[model samples]
Target: MKFVHRLCVLCLVALLLPGGPARAQSQLVLAISEGTSGGLDHGRVIAKYQDLANVIGGVLRTKVSVVFAREFATLESGMKDGKFDFVMARPSDYPARGMRDNGYHYLASAQPDGQCLIVVPKDAPIQKLEQARGKRFVMPEQVSYMSRFCRAELRDRGIDLAKENVQYVREQAAVTFYLDNKFADIGAIASYSGPARKLDKDGFRVLHRSVAQPYFPLVAHARFKPEQIKAIQMALVSLPDKAGGPEILQRIGIAAFDTSGEDRMNVLLDWLEK
Candidate 1:
């Protein structure tokens, strides 16, 4: 699996090189980052996104190759150096940075915005954000984007995690374990995360639902002209209306692409950085 993954990644990178048949052909590189710690492997990522890449290629009249970035550092460096012609990623902050500091323009975001859910045992006394103060909090690793997101949400509610009793885990599922085993009083996880889906079944309840923000944003590099960006944006927004579009969306795990998140995307880093 490792060899196959590396070979595929190399093939995609080769498309960008000069002096080959691929060089003579017009091509655009689309960098995709699910998140540094996301569960999907390279093969799964390609299967999920190749169709959308084909659609984008058709619209742009160029070959669109997909590159899966499994690490945040690689994604950030690629954006900073203008290595990716387009990017669509989750944990939104990475793409948000691409737009704010890397000259990328927000094109669209996936529907059903992401929220941080503060979870606790169903019988726990924490009924509100204020009550969560001083309680042992379990969340994803401090370096993970979701951790930053949850911290930001808690901070906004006057609950500073830095001052609170907290347990940083490597996975969201571990957050649930800490809560279940009585190792923590409260926990945080993304609403779309795996553990979040089983909250009710596992006898946990959402103590607080943080504010929704744009999720899985798609942005175009500054190299694209305004008209090109507009075209790409429209194509993505109208994807669901086209034939096979629904299947494409199902494969990609989003209902539709929203083009109205430009404002939210613009201020996302500010909110997270605060």
Candidate 2:
């Protein structure tokens, strides 16, 4: 009788995995949005989340896999296809449209809103955005949330790039290097890029700083049961207290999982719809 029950459980898990489950463990896919913030190494980015996934998997008694779609369109399509059981997306790519059009549930967010900095040499006299105008600019690629948010804010402040030499690189480190080497007059870097350390150690100064803004959000698909979702939420919220949790959270730069209400999502969706 016990053997029969074990066989039934294996059968159920087999139904969940692609190509027919060869293993008894249930598989969960945790998808991360592709960005330059983690550098261009896809393997490194995937590995970082694998540790977090292992903890979540241990909590849920399942196998978790981490993946990132290389392009926005691919991520959108994968969401629609229900390829991801959970997702970690940038603010601009909040999976808002997916939440409405598809069936994703807002789970939690990484605490402490992100900030952007317009940095120049510490010795440079550029004290404000206006002073940096018409100067050579260096920034991450347009696909980066850092670039998208910072660039929009820069334009709103009347910083014209058409008149200045602008260079977009694939990594945030490149932006700092360009500024440090005197190749660019100013650099736009996100707080996630470790801007504070760069400002202090690299001899750069903030010419302007952006208002606090929402950072990345984590979400789950409709396939998760309410109780299962709650369990996952609880696990993430308590991650900092678990063994080795502090190290993992620090490496990921998440202070804690803010499992607050959905008010933030509503606001984010409203902004996206507009």
Candidate 3:
């Protein structure tokens, strides 16, 4: 009986030993912020984020981690709110209003240049940007920066925007529908979306591609530790020119986060003010 009690006590001690669930803990709360807007799945996105974090901290020796949170409020909020330390945010939507309130600042930008494309149904006869007038054009929505940038490009080219022929539909896939059902003459999408062949089996072709813009931006909380910020900057600057580069880029869905400093963003803020 005494031997049995001793064995039970040893098992209990093993359950409570170091490296157990109660003892093992994480120090850093590294996180990626993303919006739950529209139909995007949060769980899938978070899983991708965890895989990337393993590559960096596990492979790169940064001891960092990555997490994905789908709250619109968390995504919009700034770093000083202290809820998040890092963010892989799209340039179109960051420093969302009224959360951290100090606004977000850039740490690095995806090195890949962005390209915009104009699309039309495989059967449509429209051949020119000007042909889009009085014909409905499908774009994501007003709140998206890509949509605004596309509209601004047309406006700068002297196209009138307030005409009865001009209109916007809310979803990008809607562009596919408009083309498939013959509901519209044109649509716009990321040039990288590549010929709509993958997005839809029905054919769609590119009509226009925009001059490239700054690739996606990586942002961090204003309060991120200085050492952590510097380490990230160093890692990006020294990203090897071999498999490491392509590997990291593939995980982040960009070619590289460029060495270009934050000053490059001044033009963006200027455009916003203008």
Candidate 4:
């Protein structure tokens, strides 16, 4: 199973890789829109993906803003009515990405990248997702992707989840207690939480990772003029690790981030429509 997953990821990356040829000029106010509790809040989600924008801003000497989706439905209506410029929303919010595809365009990561882990107490017998059925699954208050992420595993195992097989608990400490006290068979987590120290390396093992998409991307909007888009693209293709990106990734937890690929997230679009 692990091998199959790895193979899928590799093939996807290979297919979407960006070709050689650097864009000249780099300076633009690329905005980032993500999913959160309220409507598109570009102000709040900035700190996270801003690591990339900061690097781009420094190297190219540009400005950027981070935005969040407004109640999910507003994704399409919002971007269309106004210019969002750039966004990093979820795979589930692909419709807004598409309102500008084809001649209209957008970029998304090859990975269905979002972090949510089903963790159990360190010394538990749940080594695989199959063992998680009929057991409690604790998640965060705003974790909406659980069903989409965990569905395939359930279907594969033939687990009957229709009759409340999985109980959804929303609380921070509740999740921690469930995992730490052995109350929860599984819990989901954001990958940013401390690596060895936070996740209690000694306590738990990751049974499954919901890495079906690339980490939410720093994508360009359709309205961006060619030169403007090129500048942003150049910055992303070359981050802290790249010569011109200006070093900021290290200050944050990010080791480095770069992409060479097609600006297509259609698979996500197809899924969102379903």
Candidate maximizing TM-score: 1
Better of 1 and 4 by TM-score: 1
TM-score of each: 0.88, 0.72, 0.69, 0.61
lDDT of 3: 0.59
Mind giving the per-residue lDDT tens digits that candidate 3 earns over 18-102?
A: 7554443433445564432344465666555655555446433544556565565665543546655556655434533211255
lDDT of each: 0.88, 0.75, 0.59, 0.52
Give residue 13's lDDT in candidate 2 (0 to 100): 79
**Could you tell me which residue pairs clash in candidate 2?**
none
Query: What clash count goes with each model?
Result: 0, 0, 2, 23
Rank by TM-score, descending? 1, 2, 3, 4
Total backbone collisions, model 1: 0
lDDT of 2 at 30: 86
Better of 1 and 2 by TM-score: 1
lDDT tens per residue, model 4, 1-274: 9999999888777656543122122234444444443432455456555666565455445555444564556555555654455555553334335443523344434232444465677778878787777787666553455444444334444654454335555544456666677666677654443432366644666776654444555555566576765666666555644763344454333454434334334454444234
Where is model 2 more than 4 Å wrong at Cα?
A: 1-26, 37-47, 54-62, 68-74, 90-97, 155-165, 194-196, 225-227, 251-253, 261-274
List the candidate 1 regions with Cα displacement exceeding 4 Å. 1-25, 37-41
Structural RMSD, model 2? 5.9
Candidate 4 CA-lDDT value: 0.52
- Cα distance off (Å), candidate 3, residue 240: 5.4
